[model samples]
Target: AQSVTQPDIHITVSEGASLELRCNYSYGATPYLFWYVQSPGQGLQLLLKYFSGDTLVQGIKGFEAEFKRSQSSFNLRKPSVHWSDAAEYFCAVKLVRGSTLGRLYFGRGTQLTVWP
Candidate 1:
């Protein structure tokens, strides 16, 4: 079965600092990877995804991730952070199947607290 694990349950950062969040997955073959961020009481916004091709993929909100097949990792990184970036982040994997768009299995989530 496919699954994801996010080691950090919560993280805190100061405004204007850099940030990185870890994500690891277990799958038989190459899996679709994604990172999403959710503000308080809001739906998740896609940060980035790794479907195929290049190991490094970029996404909205100045976020990027590198897919490491060897490590079974896809970690999200931001060069610098903003106060508004404070939110809950989730790492997800889309199940690989023949027909349907498979369901996404998400990590428990990491709560990010930004200090002024």
Candidate 2:
């Protein structure tokens, strides 16, 4: 069985502080991993993805993540936090969908709070 877990339910950081959101997954083998962000009223937006090749993948909005196969973890990070960055972040895994677009299995999500 493949599952995603975001241990931290909520995290608060200063406007210019560094931020790190933890994510862990349980899968039989190396799986497709992703990180998504959801604002108050907006739909989920892809922050980054790790399909193959480089383990350290760059994403939009000055965000980045590293996929560690040994520990089955894909954690998200940002050098500095911003007031507008406050949102609910989710870690998800893509599952094969048999000839169709793969389905996404998301974690409970970690809510980010940035204080100015």
Candidate 3:
């Protein structure tokens, strides 16, 4: 079964600090990787995605993710943290070939706290 794992359920960082949310997936073949941010009382927003071609993909809001096939990981990173950046981050994976194609398998989610 394909699944996404986010090791840290909650992380706290000071404003202007660097942020990294770990994500790992389990799949036979390389599947699509995505990072989504869900602010309080808001819907999920696409932060970045890795479909193919590039190992490192840039996303919205100064976010980026590197796809490492050897580790089956697609971790999201940011150079600086902002108060507004505090939100719940979720890592998702989608299979290319299967009955569940196009269905996103999401991680449990990581709650980020930014302190000023």
Candidate 4:
């Protein structure tokens, strides 16, 4: 069984400041990892994913993440934050094996608040 955990239930950052959201996962083997953001009354949009290769992966909206196997973590980072970036962020994981969409799981949810 694969699972994802996001420690922070909410985070507040000033506009134009750096931000980082923590994420951890539990899986038997290398799993597909993702960071998604959802605005109020909107759908989740893929921020990034780790399938293979380089640990560092770039995502939309100037976001990026690093896959740390030892720590079982894939944390999201953005050097500068914006008012528009304030939203809910979710960490999700799925088996690298194909046809396992049913195994995908998401975190409780992390609300990001940005102050101007």
Among all candidates shown, the one with the greatest TM-score: 3
The residue pairs that clash in candidate 2, if any, are none
Error of 3 at 39 (Å): 0.3
Candidate 4 residue spans exceeding 4 A from truth: 100-102
Which segments of model 3 are wrong by more than 4 Å?
97-101
Q: Estimated TM-score per prediction? A: 0.93, 0.94, 0.94, 0.93
Greater lDDT among 1 and 2 belongs to 2
Tens-digit lDDT track for model 2 on 1-116?
66899999999999999999999999787778899999999999999999888999999999999999999999999999989999999999886633458778899999999999
Candidate 3 weakest ten by summed lDDT: 94-103
lDDT of 1 by residue, 1-116 (tens): 66799999999999889999999998887778999999999999988888889999999999999999999999999988999999999999887644466888899999999899
Best model per lDDT: 3
What TM-score number comes out for model 4?
Answer: 0.93
The local distance difference test score of each candidate is 0.91, 0.92, 0.94, 0.92
State the lDDT of candidate 3 residue by residue for 1-116, as single tens digits: 66899999999999999999999999999988889999999999999988889899999999999999999999999999999999999999988745554789999999999999
Candidate 4 clash pair list: none
Q: In terms of lDDT, which candidate is stronger, 3 or 4?
A: 3
